[model samples]
Target: MNWNQALFPQAGPLRVVQGEARREEPSFFPPTHLELQLQGAPDAYGIETTVSIYPLAALLQKYPEQTEGSVGQQVKALRSLLENPAPLNTAAAFRLPAIDTVNASLAVAGARKSLSSANLRGVRYLGAFSQDVRRFASTDVRYVFQGISRDGRYLVTVNGSFSGNVLPTRESLEGSGYDVAPQPQDNDKDRARYEGEVNTYFAGVNSTLDQSNSNPEVTRLDQFVELLQLR
Candidate 1:
């Protein structure tokens, strides 16, 4: 079941990032990954991953017509969402096709990161938008759930972070004063920055999913799925 409409009533963006932001405010883990690395030696033995709900604009861009069985060719498929000013896709509405595409993408992407929902134990969808940019005042709402692995093991963890932005698009982000245009960099500074921001947001959502403060936030910038696991 989809949680977008059910959890987000006041504003799409707020509802999207609320839960995730709360988790990330202190850098996801209570003590932060750096502390964990120094204290628990997690780097010696621990895996982390993160998962987030696609923004409405991203959904529209990637799955405009609900095409299936293929990756790429979707709307806004990796475009700079933070700086773009594209209109939100609230009118297009989230559909099964889009959801399917997202799930498929998740499955493939998750596998690449050594994670999958088949091992999902539970999930809490967190909204992300402009409102909770700081998350000083808000409530965390739980949305969506899938049974854990029959072996009594939570194969994967999922945090449902949403970008409360009505429909995140390139035009929308650019209007918001974010540097989202594509560029070339051998050092990949722009790519590094983008990954950092995305990871930061994703950590927020994952931290919430591990509400009790059990799982550790990821250390490596690339291992987002470290906050997410799939059996």
Candidate 2:
């Protein structure tokens, strides 16, 4: 998939190292070979490769104090769905696509795990939007799943939404005081400061996907999921 289009659709500008100095410019990184391959996978799975849910700000305001708790419950429920895929296969609302994509990746990676509906959890919705959005009136929810290979040699954690657009967009970042605009010339000192700001911006993104520590395994699963997504 086009990571830039999916994750940074509204991204303004980014800082990059151009020669010895840094330059702030609107950058466009072509989709890598791997990304292209994954994107070309069959669509029989019935899952939306790029999921654009509602905004996080609306969800927080709607859930308020119960956000974390609500998300935890949603995760647990999704795990149960993974353990049982029968409902997913028959239920149209589940959107539980076939595991061919995941399984194929595992095979290429020499993982013995066979991703199937039985072992894979259905993506669950964690939060919802308070207001409607034109014809698309859906809530912003988090999706996650964990599975172990048949031989247990590899554990698979899938933080659903392959695009990594789980958090707010650049517009939201700008509203939060982030320098979404590019810097024309970045010195060493300016780079350091900008890097820190960038880190802080990501921290906010992390917080949006952060779940409670009640389940340590889930946390580890999330970490692994992130690793796979990065790859």
Candidate 3:
């Protein structure tokens, strides 16, 4: 099932990350990797949504020798999904291909996110992630999820962000003009001033990290995940 079309009246960006090379590790093959970007609520920063779906049979048909024999069997291949929460923390990723290509979005915030054990209706061993970007006028943080379906038929991922926040990449600090970009002719004093500004900005983000306030978007997206039915 193509969730992009089903979830949105008009979906966006479902590419195979062009120039993808077959990595040395078959487990890191490229078939299970994908990309997308969806515009979401206007208020949330970097809150656009993007979901990637990869069909397992498509993987097998393309690389039968590389996939696990049992999973390749297609009839009883669901064993890959880790259901038990105890060992879920140590579980490896869904064996989807590695994303090694470059993307063209200029980012400002650190590529830091908090991850914990999580599961959606259609998938198990899913990891929930959130980034701290000094959210303003909105409780929404950039939430993301990635894991394989319970039946091992597909790999599913969800990144809640919108077209409004897609460009400039780092909505937290870069595009906000709080920490001004250093000019090519910046002197030592100018560099120090910019560094101080960035430090202050991150301190605010750290304060958010210390708070325990709940994000409503996480629950909303979780329900969306639970309702997804992947064949």
Candidate 4:
């Protein structure tokens, strides 16, 4: 796979690491992968940008979204979610990949939500997530585009971490419309209510990520993926 470097983060030097990709937990089998990083940012900034591509079988759980099925069925199901998303769909949340290992639960690792396609490959899910949702520790909030190849053999993800875009937090939720209570609610009912606000926040984040430098308003990452070719 050859990617366009110009589509990557332009702020600093882009670090390229190409080789096998691992899962959250070590596996006897290793999958081929490529990772692109933007250096010179603080820990809070996280990976300014990352692109991960790997074979579907590399994961301990082969299903794209941890669903039980054959590879074709799983790919169909994952693609269906992006194609026929529910109201304010967050399906992309289930598809985040573990950068280091193939056996991680990407769905629950961080707080994430997504809107419909941002358009690249067959599907480009415009997604948002926190590096550490429970702690709200990092200033970095990621906007990602995840998809599979037309032939259904690969899973590719492009992610960018931007600062100061934390979604609603327990403390911040004090007066965050969904929970105007003097103190944020701690019960399951509050969680149900807050779900709407969380999705709404991701929608806004998607809009911001949709824009990019230079003319025509297309994100460089999107532009880069536009030219992505895998053999």
Candidate 5:
């Protein structure tokens, strides 16, 4: 289906690094959620970042206080709660400041509750220049995500470049008025490689989700085996 091509028609060549899917079981993690990690691919925009997806239901369960308002309101409330030190446990391995970084990234994307049932539920994106380009000038690239799927079970994120001195703070990367240029190093070979990789990842996700009673732990193992067999 050329998901990337369909999603980001204007985007240049993409490289897939590490694609992993894991189910979060209830234990000490607080809320149970599905986590999908799409890593690698330094886009033509000179942006390098990983895409992470989390279910909104789990997030609300973890922070019941933030669940009272609309999706946008919830996001805002959670942002405020995560930023403060009082809500975070000092003894816990998870640091408030680190979580604040993630929350800050989500804020940069301006994820909010959806007003319409057909619309996206929430999103949050943030990025900075690579270490090599940090000193001279900033290229102003940002990664973004959209909450597709009705249940808010699937959140898709990607890396791309945007215009203006300020980084992208929009809900959707598409139609965000970003100027994307093709990479000088990209060729037909790279394009084909990216398409296959993307397809494989999505196929695995669909297959895993189709099962009525899917064991996330076992599914992860099976996925790893399938990936190994493919190679």
Candidate 6:
């Protein structure tokens, strides 16, 4: 019962089949989408007011006649809309000049619609690749690539640091055309500068986080405890 010979029959000291080559993809992932809606502005005298995306949409739908408001106010309003979600109908209600510019940028950047099922006429969603980058850059996010052997498995982890206070480290491998190894100083002085930027981003976003003791670290610890209990 020579099982090895039976499985891979080749006489005269055959070669062992090892790693499989990866299939080449037709295209890479699409870019992330960023649709911003700016609204609000000051009056002739200098009074300013603003509204959320939903409310702004309502205002736009309700009051299409008033377009000669403050430019600054409109910009602020549009920026707010991009962060917050509003109903499609609400978003359609108001028309702003910023949409054309933003959409133009999106087109140039190769951004795509979020959904394949329904129509996304006025909403904005980032591409899968962009979303992935954002998720990793959010806050202390880490990436782990896992592989297995017959006897054991191993994990390769890339721990992301904070940039700008609360934001996660962000990097892009696109547009360079090829991969290049970093120089030694590129790993230290440059790395330090990047980490510093992350610290700043996080600091700004920390205020926006839920005002609870339930930070990411706390959540991760809870998960670890639960896994331990299961074991």
Which portions of model 2 miss their true places by more than 4 Å?
Answer: 1-146, 153-159, 162-184, 211-231
TM-score per candidate, chains pooled: 0.22, 0.27, 0.40, 0.51, 0.30, 0.16
Candidate of highest lDDT: 4
Given candidate 5, what's the lDDT at residue 199? 44
What are the per-residue Cα lDDT tens digits for candidate 5 across 12-98?
Answer: 333343433323421123233333233333444444433334455554455445222323344554344334424322211111112
Model 2 lDDT tens row, 12-129: 2322212222123212111111212112212332233222212223322333333322422333433455576555323322233222122111100100122343222233222211
C-alpha local distance difference test of each model: 0.27, 0.30, 0.41, 0.46, 0.31, 0.24
lDDT per residue (tens digit) for residues 1-231 in model 4: 665655554433323444444345334233555555533343643555666666655543533444443343445555665555552234444443333323323322232233222333433433333332222322324445556665666677666554443344434544444322233378887776666555564455444444422223224445666677665
lDDT (tens digit, per residue) of candidate 1 on 85-136: 2322111112101121232222001101111233232222222223212221
Model 6 spans > 4 angstroms off:
1-21, 25-165, 168-222, 225-231
Misplaced by over 4 Å in model 5 are: 1-49, 67-140, 152-231
228 Cα displacement, candidate 3 (Å): 1.2
RMSD of each: 18.6, 20.2, 10.2, 7.4, 19.9, 26.7
Instruction: State model 6's lDDT.
Output: 0.24
- lDDT tens digits, residues 120-190, model 6? 11222211111111222332221111111112111111111111123223333233321122322546788
lDDT of 6 at 75: 35
Let me know the TM-score candidate 2 reaches against the reference structure: 0.27
Pairwise lDDT winner, candidates 2 and 6: 2
Among all windows of 10 consecutive residues in model 5, the one with the lowest summed lDDT is 107-116
The pairs that clash in candidate 3 are: 39-162, 39-163, 40-162, 47-161, 47-162, 48-160, 48-161, 48-162, 49-161
Ranked by TM-score from best down, the candidates are 4, 3, 5, 2, 1, 6
What's the C-alpha lDDT at position 190 in model 3?
Answer: 78
